[model samples]
Target: MITKIAQIEILPGQEDAFEKAVTEALPLFLAADGCDGVDLQRSVEHPSRYRLMVRWETVKHHTVTFRASDAFTRWRALAGPHFAAPPKVEHVYPVLAH
Candidate 1:
């Protein structure tokens, strides 16, 4: 499986707005071909920071399947403006598991 982590920092008072936007935007992933699942988490120490952890069958599933789809465009249109800056995205592969 491939994991994608997006670190989003919301502008000061935009936390509630960002979270609401993300919640509304999440359904777009359901239409993605290889999207296994996605989870959103917030930083306890930093209310304005959030993390999106997504799992896909392969990296190409995200880079190709999802990114190429119209849903992505809509998703971005809905969620893009809430970002403090462009999110920092990272891809990772699991090395160990319990």
Candidate 2:
């Protein structure tokens, strides 16, 4: 599996609403064709920051399939407005040893 991490920084007071939107959109990720699972993490030191981790059967599933689908638009509709800036997204493979 490949893991895609999106580092998000929301506007100072938007965290609550952002989390709510993400919660409502959780099933969208799970229902995607090649998605395995996903999780959202909040920083204790920086409450306005979030890390969205999504696991996919392959990188193409995220980069191509999901990104090109209506679900992506829906996700962006919910989460995009709260973004302090464009998210930093990347895909990585498990090291296993680490």
Candidate 3:
């Protein structure tokens, strides 16, 4: 599997709203094809920073398939407004895990 990590910075004062929006959009990721799991984490030192992690069967599952779907549009609609800047995204393969 591959994991997609998106580092997002929310607009000041919009942190709570951003988190709520992401939580409300969980089903979009869960129901996506080839999606294995999804998680969101906030940085304690940077309250406006968030990391969105999604596990997929392959890189294409996220970049090609999901990005082309209506769900992608919906996701952006829900969360885009809170963004301070476009997110930085990357994919990683597991090196070791329990």
Who wins the TM-score comparison?
3
On the 0 to 100 scale, the lDDT of residue 33 in model 1 is 89
Candidate 3 backbone clash number: 0
lDDT of 2 by residue, 1-98 (tens): 99999999999999999999999889899999899999999999999999999999999999999999999999999999999999999999988854
In the range 1-98, model 3's lDDT, one tens digit per residue, is 99999999999999999999998889999999999999999999999999999999999999999999999999999999999999999999999899
Off by over 4 Å in 2: none
Please provide, for model 1 over 21-75, each residue's C-alpha lDDT reduced to its tens digit, 9 standing for 90 to 100: 8788788886688888889999999888899888988999999989999988988
Q: CA lDDT of each candidate?
A: 0.87, 0.95, 0.96
Instruction: Report the Cα lDDT for residue 79, model 1.
Output: 75
Worst 10 residues of 2 by lDDT: 89-98
TM-score for each of the candidates:
0.93, 0.96, 0.97
- Deviation from native of the Cα of residue 55 in model 2, angstroms: 0.3
Off by over 4 Å in 3: none
lDDT of 1 at 40: 91
